[model samples]
Every structure is written in structure tokens, then in C-alpha cells.
Target: MTPDEPRSRLADLGVGPGAFTRGRHNAITDVSGVLVGHSTVHTDRLHTGVTAIVPAELGAERRWLPAGLAVGNGYGKLVGATQLQELGAVETPVLLTSTLSVYRVADALLGHMLEQPGYERTTTLNPVVGETNDGFLSDIRSRPLGDAHVSEALTAAAGGRVAEGSVGAGAGTVALGFKGGIGTSSREVPVGDGRYTIGALVQSNFSGTLSIAGVPMPADELVSAPPAETVGNSCMIVVATDAPLDARQLTRCARRAIFALRGVGSDFSQGSGDYAIAFSVGNGMPPADATLSPLLHATLDAVEEALINSILMATTQVHADGNRAHAIPLAAVHSRLAAAGVI
Candidate 1:
């Protein structure tokens, strides 16, 4: 792997240095009240897990969190599109499971929510669930995940340092032909005349020709031999912020994650369905009732920073099947930057 800074978290990857800032942990948890949890299932045959992202606030009427969605490619599945599109808001936690396990995970999430004291009284429920393929090293057809796993992940989540690399759903995945799974990063943006936080968590399963910032490199020289393309891959990006942005604006920010992914050498191949979702944990001040032009610009800035953090923070991983993928090295990256006159 390229020797950048021996970092396992995305924030340490070093992007747009000395300008935009980062949170304490350089994770989506930097956004106040955002909590993340994961349930990984790795056996002799199957390897996969479920990651749950809990927004600090819940319900359509709760005026603390505003959210948005961006779909780069629609070939994949997401459970809450209709409600999110209709009301421009989400009321439940965001869950990321394998492609075929969406329904089971969603049901489990809803059931888990009902068990909570405040959530049971609610009439309607909608849990946002996203997924990617992990069939390469995992026996996906086994449906390793169940209600208990989803509930455990959701209840166990808390805001703070989030573990990465094989700890969660990313456990059995691959990136650019190497072992890939979950990666996270964050950025602090100037807001209200000061700095506010925005961060991202990504399930990195996309494919490419294996380049660090578009500079093609030999595989064995850096990461282990690339994996066989059994199934086309995809990614699910979750952006979290304390900035007050409506759904449309949050979506605009979400799509910009592609820029950061590309900067890290992801080409968004044909089979890759790069999807992103953004949420604001700030007091969900209504757009209809409030007027602030400067806040909009601040929101945009946060989105860009948050997206870049996701890639810069991700590190390489090795899976149970004896397959390994290394993070793009920084030493080689420096040479490429100087050669391209980018430095």
C-alpha cells in the first residue's frame, strides 16, 4: 500500500490540508448526536455484516434533524425512497446490510424501534436501509443476519469514535480489487462565522483499475493480488452534519462524495451504483419558517469536506478468505502528485 500516514481511519488520510478542519475523531460521529453501530457475521463460508447509523433525532415532526438523499445510479435498492422523496425527511435509523437482506434488516430495525420506550407509540414507521454485494467471500444466500443482529447493532450504537476496517458490514467486502469494507472520515466547516462539523461513513465495495488518485500502479507491488470479479460492486455513503440543510440541499451535498471518491481513485465503474445520503442533526429549523442565505453556503462547504473525509480516512483490509487489499500508499502518491505537477 502507498505509505501516506499509517492511518486506519479516514480523517488521517490528509485531504485539503491546512484549510478545512476535522472533528475530534474525524468520523461522522463528529456531527453531534450521530451514533454508529455494526453487526458482523463471518464464518468458514460466509462473510458479511450490518451497519446501523442512528440519527440523534427521530420522527417527521422532530425539528432537530433535516435530511436529504442522492442516488448516483438507481440500479440498486434503498428501502425509504418514497417517504424521503414525498416528505423530504426521514424518521428512523439508516441501516446498511447485504443486497438481498434489505427487507429482513428493515423489519428488524422497525421492531427494534418499537421496543424502545418512545418509538412504540408511533403510528407509521419507515426505516432507511441500503446495501451492497458481499457475495465474493461471504455465502450471502445463507442470510446470516436476523432480527437479533439488527436490534443489537441499533441499541448498541453511540456517538464517538467509530471502529473501522472489518469491524462491521465492511468485514467481508473489497475495494478496487483488494479486501474492502467500511471506511469513515470527517471535516469541520466554517459555519455561523465559526467552524461546524460534517462527516461521512462509506461502505467501500466499488471496483476500478486499482489506482491511487488515478495513477495506475502494479497490484502485487502495493496490495495483494486483486480478487476475481464474481459480482459487480457498489458503495453506500452516509453523510452526517450539524449544518441545517433541507433534503434537496443535503442531496446536492451527498452527490459531491463522488468527487472525493474519485480523488482517491474510484472511477465509478458501470456495475457500481454509488449512492449517498445526507442528514443534518442540527435543530431541524423549518425552511418555510426561517430565512438565512449564508447558512446555505455553509451547508455546501460542509458537504464537500465531509465527502472527501470518507475516502481519505479509509484504510486497506484483508478478509477471511485469505484475500487482502491494502490502502493506497502515500509515498507513491507523492511521486504521482509531483509527476503530474499537482503538488
Candidate 2:
């Protein structure tokens, strides 16, 4: 499929009505004031880009948002992770890009924040940047990303439908033996007399047996085994919510997001860097422990759908060296799910 072709999401295929209701857009942007943008850098040999997640309170009236991190494998680079954990907050927009370009992206993000109207006297700032290796489909060692790409993404941030598949940092990613990219989903939960939204966004580039709704893809239908060189890769998950959850609660939400990978069949390989970063933009008193169950359940549902969407929405990509990663065959997948009565 061409990069511009419209892609289908898990919901469009009638995959679920999980424990909670989905937000209007069924995307992370469904969380109030959360915006997402992408800057794609696609060329013959350079198929990488950047994605920026800008929270509402990040600009002139900048206020640190409560945030938490959970590491599943800890084999990839996540800048500002320690500081985020230590202070239980995020002071800048989160950025995602290729592994080699992470440092450059981080520097650019730092610059972007420092230039904000209220930061004229800023001394120290922590910019959170996450990455997943895209070496197999891109010339990763060349480090193609630059400040311009970052600025483009940050400037384009918007709170509506998010563009998925082979765009942004997901441009050259591979997952479950198929073409992989960016994906997102959100859920709405009712607690006390109020309702909250939990959303998830994922950059899937790891290896695994493709599974959908508890049904695994037949071995014969596999898109050939994942290339040996790309076997142990990684996945980055970001969770956002408008729920009044504290840092500790957000950390729990992050862990639940990581566990959602099991439903999609990820093996969590030794070299895979699986991580989940969760942050809350809500205010007022946090919910009681008894009321937290629905939030956790919502986290699991949204994250699983987001992971699946990452694979389903991806288009086939060909590397400069002639190696290719094919998109999963939707027809076959549907048949499998039907045969198993999962649809």
C-alpha cells in the first residue's frame, strides 16, 4: 500500500468493546489538550522521522506534569528517564525518533523548550526523548534527523486525529514479522460522579508471533521469519490520561501498559527495550484506590488496541538494500479471527 493510503484501525474491524467505552477519536489526543504531530523524513535510504507529543501545559504557562516510567526490558535509550522518575514529573513535550538520532532530537527538543516565551531565564530543563532502532529499514548509522525535523513536528502538534502507520519515527520500523509503525487508542472510564480518559500511543518495532484478540496468525501465513538481524528490537509506549492520578498511580498505569503486550504476543526478548511512560494532565484530588481498578482496566484495553493498530495500519516498506518488510495480510487475518469466532 502507498504511504498515503487510508489505514484501518482495530475498532473499524469490529475487534472489541473491552471493559470501557472508547473516546470520540479513540486516540491519545482524546485526552483533553494532548496533541500529537509527526515529521516524516523519507528518502531512498533514509526512512526515519520524529513524533512530538505536546501536552497542554507545556508552553508559556509551563508547569511540570505528573509522570511515571516503567521499564520492561531496559535495553534501549530513554533520555530524561531518571530525572522524570526522581522528580515524578515531565517538564517538556515528549519526543520519539530513531535510536541513533535520539541525542540530536533531545538537544533540539531542549532548544525548542528553552525558546518558549516563559523560559528566558531557564537554567536547567529535562527533555524526554524515546527511541526504537530502525536500522534494518533505514541507514540508521547516518543519523538523518536534525533540528528542522523536530521543529516541524513540534510546530505541527494538534489535538485531533493522529496519523499512524509508516510515518514519523515509525517510518522504517518492523514488528511481528510485518511492517510496523505508530498506532494509538483511548478509553473512557467512569469513576465516582466523573469520567476520565486514558489513551495510549505506541511505536512498535519488536519481533513476535502476530496475535489478534487471542488468536495467533497461522505459522504458514507468517511473513517469513523476522530477519535474524532484526529479531531483538524494541517498542516504546506512551500513556496519557485526564484522570486525577498521582505519580505513583501513573507508574502503576505504565506497568499495566507494558503487560498489555502479552495479549498481542510479544516475547519481550532479551535485547528488546520495552518501556511505558505515563503522565496525567488532570487536577484536583486523586481518586480512591477502589476507584483505580477501572483506570487500570482502561489502560490495558487501550494499550492492546494501540499495539495492534500499529501493525494493522502499517504499509509495506522496502529498504535501500532491497530488503523489505511486508504488511500483514488483512484478508488472512480476518479469516483466522473468524474461524476462531473472535470477530
Candidate 3:
């Protein structure tokens, strides 16, 4: 069997870096009160869907999560980012979908928010939506992801182990010429008081050379690989933490996440629109600067693993239009990392 066929994430390889511990689920949902849901539409002609991340109860109208935005490259359409940057908070659930499907998802999310018990008569709510183009593998022009699909995901939101790869907004996405999708991981940072959990989720749809555990994917496998293509040029990162942090600290965590992206070989090309959004469920303000290193370090490591998990958990896919995206070969990747003394 080919390495790409393996069903596993980065931790399954036992080569991930960092000294921090992981949460029970090793997913973003490990952060208290965080929930993730996905609605995938993978058919012969259309392969796209929506993913919703909820940090609080749906009916809490006045309650909002402290959030921050960091743009690795400003080539994205993260709706409500201006407000998030200015106000440092998000009032509605976060949804991600195909590039062309973002608007519909946003509208549907707005409906869901307004319909929530406390939002009655609430004039305007900023819906946070992000996207990557799935045009190459799917008929993105068809805009198959609609309000109903978005509602399904919202309704399905729950906390626990999350489904990854080839699902949600990542259904038809490609990354680094490989089959890329939704991936998640978490890390727990120990402090003098108590350990805090930091979790990360990524919709990886950017292009770059695949690297695992600090080693480049071996070239021999690439030479024998089937043809693959990148449909989108962006990545969306969502980081959640149980630690008491304000929007400013979350923004710093996201900046560290961006640095972690480079560790996985992301080229950050001009066409790429990489963005990271981070939030905390706690109401307390950020900690002292000296004490924030653990959080930043935790974010860096988790983001790296989350990005790696996207390709590792993905399987090669063939689109109806004859375009294809190969999965990053896991066995070859492990072997290469071993040869490089990185594992």
C-alpha cells in the first residue's frame, strides 16, 4: 500500500516537536466551550462544504469572545476582520467555506445568530467568514454551498474529537499540490498555577513543498507521483485557548502560528492569502508578558502539527474535471524524516 493511504495525523508518526502536552482530544474542541461542525458536499461534479466553529453558547447574545486577527498575507476575504481588529471580538459563530460560497454562508450564519434567543431585534451582527478557492477540484462556479448547508453545520456544532481531512470547507481543497483539508491539534502549556490548553484548526489550501518533522518530502516519491494541482491560494487558521487572554495576546499567538507555517515549508507567495484568527473562552485579561511565552510556544508547535495533520490525514482525490491532487505520502515522509535525523 502507498504511504498516502495511511489513516493518521502527525502525532501518529511520533515525530512532532515540542515539550508541551496535548489535551484529551488533541483538537480545538479541547478548549472549553469550543465546538466544531462540518457539512461536506462531495459529489461527482461538486466538492465543497462549510465548517462552523462556535466558541460559546448560541443563545448568548451579549456575550462575545475576545478574538484577534493576524494576516500573513492580506489576500483573503475574512469578513468582519476590520471589526474584529478594531473591536477585538466576534459576536457570531465563525464559518469557513469555498471562496465563492463565503457570502451565502455568512448570510446563513447571520440568520442563525439573529434567530438565537437573545439576538431578537439585534440590528446588525458581524459574521466572521473565511474561504479558499476550491475551483480546480470542484465546480466552484456552481456555488453549491448555500444557506441550508451552512445551517446544517451550525446545527451540528459540538465539542469532542473532530472529523478531519477531506471534509467541511476543505472538501475540494489542495495544499502544496497535495490533497489538503481540515486538520486540528492541541497543546497544553504548564504554568506555575495550572496548565492551559491551546488548540488549533486549519483549513489548509495553500501551496508549498511538503515537509514533515522538519524534513522535506523525499524527491523520489514526487518523481513517481501522479499529477496534482492547487485550486486555492490561501489558508485559514483558527486557534482557541482556555487560557485567559485578550485579543492582543491572541493576536500574538496567531503571529507565532504564522511563524510555525514557515516551519512546514509554506512559501507565502504573493497569490497566497494566509490569515489566522484566535480567541479565548475566558474573560480575564492577558497575563504578564513574561508568562506568555509558554502560550506562544504552545501555539507555534500546535499550529505546525495542525498543518502537517491536514496532508497526513488526507487521501488523494480525483475531480470530475480530470484534475487531481495526490495525498502527501506518509511512509515516504517518515522515512525521509528518519534519514535526516529529524524523527
RMSD after CA superposition, every candidate: 4.4, 1.8, 2.1
- Once superposed on the true structure, which residue ranges of model 2 sit more than 4 Å away at CA? 1-6, 218-232
Q: Which pairs of residues have clashing backbones in candidate 3?
A: none
Error in Å for residue 268 of model 2: 0.7
Higher-TM-score candidate among 1 and 3?
3
Clashes (N, CA, C under 3 Å) per candidate: 13, 0, 0
Best by lDDT: 2
lDDT of 1 by residue, 241-271 (tens): 7776677767666767545566555667777
Global lDDT of each candidate? 0.66, 0.88, 0.82
TM-scores of the models, in the order given: 0.81, 0.96, 0.95
For model 2, the local distance difference test gives 0.88
- Tens digits of per-residue lDDT for model 3 on 84-183? 8999888888898999888888888888778878667789789999998888789888788777898889889899998888889988888877788899
Residues 1-343, candidate 2: write the lDDT tens digits: 2342456788887787588988999999999999999999777787789999989776767569999999999999999999999999999999999999999999999998888888999999999999999898899999989799999999899998999988999998888878888999999999777899999999998877878898987433655545323533899999999998899999999999999988898878989999899999999898987888989999999999999999889887877788677777777777888898888
lDDT of 1 at 75: 64
If both were scored by TM-score, which would come out higher, candidate 2 or candidate 3?
Answer: 2
Model 1, C-alpha of 40: deviation from truth (Å): 1.7
